[model samples]
Target: MHMMLMADEKRLCKRFFHFRIAACARAHLLRRSVCAGFLTFLIAAVFCLSLFSAAPVKADDKVLRVLAWPGYADADVVNHFEARYKARVEVTLVDSDEALWAQMHAKGTPPFDVLAANTAEIQRYTEANLLAPLDLARLPNTRKQLPRFQALASIGGLTSGGKAYAIPFTYSSMGLIYDRKQVAVAPRTMRELWNPRYRGKVLDFNSAQHNFSFTALALGYPHPFQLDPTEMRTIAHKLVDLRRNLLTYYTLPEEATAFFIQHKVALMFGNYGTQQVELLRRAGADVGYVIPDEGALAWLDCWSMTRAAADPPLALAWINYMLEPDVSALLTQRQGLANTLTAPVESSDSARIVWIGPVENIQRREDLWARIVSGDRSERF
Candidate 1:
């Protein structure tokens, strides 16, 4: 009987290892809430065990292809997924959302089977029919996710025509990162980035979409994503002011971190927020992060399968494995990003986080932003 219990536990561990100990899953575990799935897992495990008590045979030569932002698919996470499922995992990192879109549509079959993108970007992918309808049956661990994330259809870009497309992954607010040693007081508003006191010491992300939207947010525009042409002119002038204040605009999180340390940056528009915080702290910098009174812009990134998925079941396995407590916890511990499956002790929830959405006039914003950065005066807009 003891041997049977031990064997059953091992089997159960394999089926639900990701959720058995995570904060998001622990709460549900204590409530005896996973009984239904647990039963299903037990039956499934028994069937698999009947095949072999040793490692399962690799079914095919297909590799599970993945495209994601940095820190999402750490080495250990991929290795574990590969080992458990007897499949190879290939990962590609995308720097920006625009880059991700270009890659996704770069021909017939994408180089990825699964990809991570925010709600706003996924809306574009879904609209373009570049994604495959998610088969929830294959990813039983979806039950282990946070209740808020479970309703994928409710999110703008995740579902259409009664089919789910993505699984909520990591999220973070692009808040303010101020140098505590240099600045005596923490900044309290987005408008403070324009303060002349930090001239030539402030860093902003070199992204047209972010700057235009951030400026609108700073000006108290009702919807930062949807702006009128007149609003564009007003925000353009604000960008010119911000441009004069900035030491240099950054492209990637790593670039922002390196600039912060090398240039003695006093303040930064932390596009990656805590992820950037982690990178800076690792480099031995004293920085303070905050979502100012005006609120911060946030992105809800999720995992979705591409229509060109090399192996659909294998792709779903990666998603389910990622939802595991250990994998999700690693996101907070390593990257400092919030996991959808677990709440970090550092308070992932903000009173005001303006999640990103599709913006109006993509070309116009890019054009005007270029002009502003190229020393275009306010009148140019």
Candidate 2:
């Protein structure tokens, strides 16, 4: 009976050991399943977080659309302005006054918030009610400008109906550029353009308004911009005479430079003034620039706000920024343009700078100029 009882106890111990082992296996399987589910959940969470991070953020809404000349709004300059104002700048570059006019009048409200134009164009814009009156109070940098620019009333086309519409930014005198090797002495007057000795070696700007004005100056007309019908006909004949002396009429500074180098041009009307001089010098042309004794036609480019500015304050800020010393100096350094903040070294005190004004009749001049360019005879005038 004792042996049987001991065997029973051993069997009971073996059964308990088996049961414990099964329970341990079940627990281990449950732990692995829980770990696998947890791992899947963590990966999904990481992927979701990455997707959220990869989403694009909205861009800045403050955009300043600018219409300017080639060197006026350079990439670096525009970038600096954008960073300072925390806004994006869209720059549109126009090469000619006609192109600028087309861009300004293309849309009903003038797509640009602000633009750079010469004083004559400023007057045209004012007459058309395309510009807004500038608030002097907003542009504190005007105090830093030279005395000439400070006297806004003295500058033609800046003010209309007692309201100031523009601020002077840069200026250049239309003078004469001659090759040092070809010409011994600098040309003293605009009459040198028609010198018979330099025929087929002279280059002129292909513009109606400027050609008429300078021809009037050459003829000793008191007011070049206010020519009468008789004066216009006389000047047109004079230009026809000039056309005989021309190698070709150039519209851009670079084109003129190429012509000077390639064609061995002896004389040229420096339409871009010192800016062209800089370009020619950089191109290794030994050229001399001189303002004629009669007086050189000058264009004072200014900044003006459009009548349909989306943000007036922002537009005013751009104008004010342009007047800053650094910005103004950059214009001179890069473009060779004379800024209003400082006096130009290239200009002489004795040089007469005739600022451009509204012309007598633009359409008439354009019509005559087109005919002249097409080889019209002097008798047609």
Candidate 3:
């Protein structure tokens, strides 16, 4: 009986060992299956996430192309507009009116939706049928502008056949900027630019229209823009003489400030007016701005839409956005330009501000100015 019990125990032990081995094998297979399933899921999830990441958030997103001067469409300002409108703004800055004109007329280039130009240029653009007349009703913010700006017809070059073309944004007199240390007293007249004492120490704007206009003002011409052939010839010679005194001709205000500091320049033709003064003072220079006795040429830059605007509503929105008090105030606070909404802190009460008018002949002035800039002799004029 004891032998029989021993055999039974041995059999039971072998059977228990076999059962345990089978259980262990089953557990191992279950874990492997779970892990493989998890790996497949993870890979598929990652692929889907990458596809979503690569696609555009909005397939029908709009883009606004703007052509303007520096400080007109600053990055921060544009970013605000983009966020508010849910659109992309591409800003192209031009330093001079000539550069602006060239960009507007460039062949094979993508057209701009809106642009900033002086009233005179607005007239030029209108006559060429390059600009579309604005619907003032669409621009509600224009109501916030001063009475002078609201009455567009009262302002020259902004209307044609009783239809307004542009809305005024900012204005500044093309005054004179002088280093306070070098110029003991404020310059009394534009003639000071030609003074022998400041020769090789003066800086001038590299603009043909303005150069001729201001020189005509200094020479006491009844109509600077309406100069006859003889007056044009005389003004051209005067510009040649003025060129002899220039340290250099500058297109942008920042470039003028750089030259002023690096070379210790004494005087500059402030094409940008108080904007240059603000820039110079910020750069740690003691400078003063003055509108000469003959009166300073001023510009009233306005916003206008192009004839080829892809979206007229979007273009009008941009124009209206510019006149917003906050946006217009930024023009005054950051750029030292006077906005149409508020009174400027920088006073021009002392000097006359001659708003620029359309020239007698744009091509003639351009041609003469080109030769003058290229060092043409006085006799050639």
Candidate 4:
């Protein structure tokens, strides 16, 4: 009996070792396959494990394809995610929503599974039926996100069917970035920039929508995104009043940063928490970013999955992984941008307002911006 028991014990040990070895191999293979289809891979792995008692898995099978803003995803992010999950990620950058939409539409295959776009483009993509609804159950990190961000990710229109079409990534309020060395006392209101003392010494965003919204704010009308016809007209009048004082209106942050470095502009309106602030500071520019009492127009960017995605599961995995506090924190910390992750590593009231909050009635101003840019509203200026 003793000999028989000894033989049984040996058999059990061998079986256990075999199981472990197989699991390790499977883990590696699954990582490669699902890295791009993050959550989808997890589900498929479970199914595979149940079927194959001892299957070899390769790590390279899991490369997630991602499309985001320049500087949003870097080698560091890819390394971290890949190391943790044993997967790889390929990232691409885009400049504007129009460009992103056009590319995806033209390709039809949505070369990437994930895309990053602003709120306006997010709406446009969803309307064009080029986006897919996000699977919230697969994303545990979504629970950590704030309420306002949650709303932004969901489509409210009946045509949109109230589905969650995107994930809120980051946002910034339109505020002035000033050189502390030049302006010992910062201007308290948008109206202050109108003073002749700062004429031809200010930089602003070239965006018609953003400027229109800011104009509404300056006119003491409701927020630009929520403007009525009367408010729109009033804001239009305010914009014309400042045309001469404006040195130049710029779209990219780099343009403004250059001007600030050269002392070409004493004050410039910039997006809060963008890479520009960090870059300017690194260059030894005494820059101060602020959102005055008038409250500034807010803009947000989001992560959207393409409807033509080849591996929806892999895309879900990357989305869920990015929502993790550690991941979100790393992204925001490096980029100097705010994320949806609760209890981030640091905060300022300015960053807090821009990174968090509802759309805050900004869509109302879209038409206003179109009119202004087309010269239809030029008379008001």
What is each predicted model's overall lDDT from 0 to 1? 0.81, 0.86, 0.87, 0.64
Give residue 349's lDDT in candidate 2 (0 to 100).
Answer: 40
Better of 2 and 3 by lDDT: 3
RMSD of each: 19.6, 31.5, 28.7, 23.9
**How accurate locally is residue 204 in candidate 4, as Cα lDDT from 0 to 100?**
65
* Whole-model lDDT, model 3: 0.87
What's the CA error at residue 243 for candidate 3, in Å? 2.1
Model 2: weakest 10-residue lDDT segment is 17-26
Tens digit of per-residue lDDT, candidate 1, span 129-154: 88999989988888988888898877
The candidate scoring highest on TM-score is 3
**Candidate of highest lDDT:** 3
Residue 306 accuracy (lDDT) in model 2: 94
Pairs in clash, predicted candidate 3 = none
Roughly what TM-score does model 2 have, to 2 decimal places?
A: 0.82
Error of 2 at 55 (Å): 11
By lDDT: ranked, best first: 3, 2, 1, 4
lDDT tens string, model 4, 1-381?
A: 999999879756644543453354346446645775877877799978966874455654766778787666777777787787666677876654434655675644437788887766677677778788987787777778888666643433212565687777776566677778767887677676677777667766655556666666666664445556676667666665555466555555655565567645777777544566776887788787767677765567777788867778878877887787777776566766778766444444543232222233444554555454333434543
Q: Sort by TM-score, best first: what order?
A: 3, 2, 1, 4
Stretches off by above 4 angstroms in model 4 are: 1-65, 79-90, 106-111, 144-162, 226-237, 272-274, 344-381
Which digits, one per residue and each the tens of the lDDT, describe model 2 over residues 206-257?
Answer: 8888999999998999999999999999999998888656777777787678
Question: Which has the higher TM-score value, candidate number 1 or candidate number 3?
Answer: 3
- Candidates 3 and 4 compared: the better one by TM-score is 3
